[model samples]
Target chain A: MQKQKIIFISLFVLVIAYFGGSYLYKNWYTQNLDFMAKENTSVFIRPHSPIYGDANAKNYIIDFFDPACETCKAFHPFVESIMKKHPGKFKLVLRYAPFHTDSYYVVQMLEAAKFQGKYDETLNVLFKYQNRWASHHSPNISLIWAFLPEAGLDVEKLRDDMKKPEIDAIIKQDITDGKTLGVTKTPQFFVNGKPLIKFGYKELQELIESEL
Target chain B: MPPLQKTSNLAWNILFLCWLTATIATLGSLFFSEVMMFPPCIMCWYQRICMYPLVIIFFVALFPLDTKVVKYAQPFVFIGLFFAIYQNLLYYKILPESAQPCSQGVSCTSDYINWFGFLTIQMLSLIAFSIILILLLFFKRKAI
Candidate 1:
């Protein structure tokens, strides 16, 4: 009985410590966000960026993202959920960083699709099929075109628009701005023009919620 | 007096807790990768190589109350700890991306789930290994 009691207490302590550590870390997360938000920047969101959710929403999330980034692919669903949860409370302005070798082509494709009012559909398809064509090490860039049909995009028109100087300029301006802002990574987010001090889903959500 | 015996009891209990922790870590890692579909990077695989063996070895030792389990398990636990520390360094950008072994597959530093802005998969593995090492060391000293 004593041995059983000792074992029970031991397990209980470990469980408590796990939860305690998580709780304490959450408090620290919030404090760090508060510190990071002290100096909000005007250049976080650009006028030409693609907007998701309610464009009129008071709280904005300016996200610098690379379509080829695996982490960005994973985070896409979570980011969509924020807009779902808050309705018109928040919106996201997406800035293309195009960090990977083939990511520039994908961003160009996205801009071309946007011209035909297929931005959301193309974005969804790209993210869904990211693993196939967006690989950082050995990206099969040609394979991305095969998935466009599923997203209801006109292949010939998309190809034509992809070569447009305007599309190139959009990609270039976003990349320049991202560099100026010291964004060395994909899926870098700023909530209400205040950069996230750390990268975490909970941290991003909490920061956006606080702004809302 | 009773204090010495109490210490012995605590150490023994901690050994049991170590087993429990390893069991959870093993299962939790599987759940994340298999069920949750969070792909494991190369470092994660290395850590798994170290941790997976521990679950079986620890379970075998638990039934017989074998203190010799610690002697056999220490190397694997230590290796797992090493990988976890290396992973944390990569995740924090303290180590350069060029040094990452995951050049072909998933990026080693990718954030799968940063729970509470701190607990990544690597951090969780580090915590598990640390507890197991400390508990085993304590029990070894107590001659459990």
Candidate 2:
């Protein structure tokens, strides 16, 4: 009976510690958001980060995304449609968080496409044919190469440009920033530095609307 | 083996409680997956398979108190308890992710509803299965 009581007390303490830990972690998550949301924080935006809509827009949507994430692919059009609702009011700055295996290679393809002014079509095509290339278990760069032509990308130019150091630096910085922002999942969105703390399509819309 | 003799109301009631446990567990699993729309991971599905059938099996066993129905239900309880323990191990990351299913889409590790930040759907299943297994063992001893 005494041994059982000791075991029961230990389990109770462990449960308390578990709840306490997540609470502390949540506080840290909010504190990091508050710090990065401050104006002119380089962590929010870098010079090379891809942006859609008016660059001068007051409202910024920082999307920390993995190219291979299914949720990110699903949210792609939804986010665009959201921007369409409030034209020129919001600028989406995409930050790479390549959490998936071999997603870095896909990110390279995307960053390389920018050099030839085919970034938009490339992103669309990659998303369209994501299942063929980003197979989760065995991502194949060759398969992505086959689909790039549909996006009118100069395959030769893209190959050469992807080997550059600048794209690598951009990915590295975005990854570092993503960690600092407490991004554990893909399609993590922040509007004007305020994170979409509660995850839902409706929550995203509300956050965007409030910022608007 | 001799047939079960006329048992007291307390014994019958306790046996019925086993079915009640299974019934509640089935409804809870359905509620989380169907109503709440949280997609069940592969591990969740496996645990459900080992759990859902016991509701009917135990109910059949209780109405007549057949030893054979209890025998059939015992394997399910043991299997479900194993799944519950294995799932908790995977959920807590004690087991490596290489063995985990749904590594790509709708990550098995994704905390759909983390109650008290520690108790997850898997942990809840673990608790339910553990209780049912214990009750079933006591019922088995009473049957003999």
**Fraction of true A-B contacts recovered by candidate 1:** 0.07
What is the C-alpha lDDT profile of model 1 across B25-99, one tens digit per residue?
A: 976787666544466888889999998888778766765467788889999999999999998998888999789
lDDT of 2 by residue, B52-106 (tens): 8987776566554565666788788888888788878877889987897667655
Model 2 segments more than 4 A misplaced = A1-48, A64-78, A97-102, A114-118, A125-140, A147-157, A160-207, B1-9, B12-41, B55-69, B84-128
Error (Å) of candidate 1 at residue A178 is 0.5
Q: What TM-score does each of the candidates earn?
A: 0.49, 0.58
DockQ of 2: 0.04
In candidate 1, stretches whose alpha carbon ends up further than 4 angstroms from where it belongs are: A1-42, B1-144
Q: Per-residue lDDT for A170 in model 1? A: 85
Interface RMSD per candidate (angstroms): 7.3, 10.6
The model with the greatest TM-score is 2
Worst 10 contiguous positions by lDDT, candidate 1 chain B: B30-39
Query: Going through the candidates in order, what is chain B's TM-score?
Result: 0.90, 0.87
Clashes in model 2: which pairs? none
Model 1, range A1-212, lDDT digits (tens) per residue?
76656556756776676556555755664455445445534356656788778867888788899888888888888988988999998888899988677778988999999878899999899889888885554557799889999889999999999999998988888988776555766788877756665689999888888886
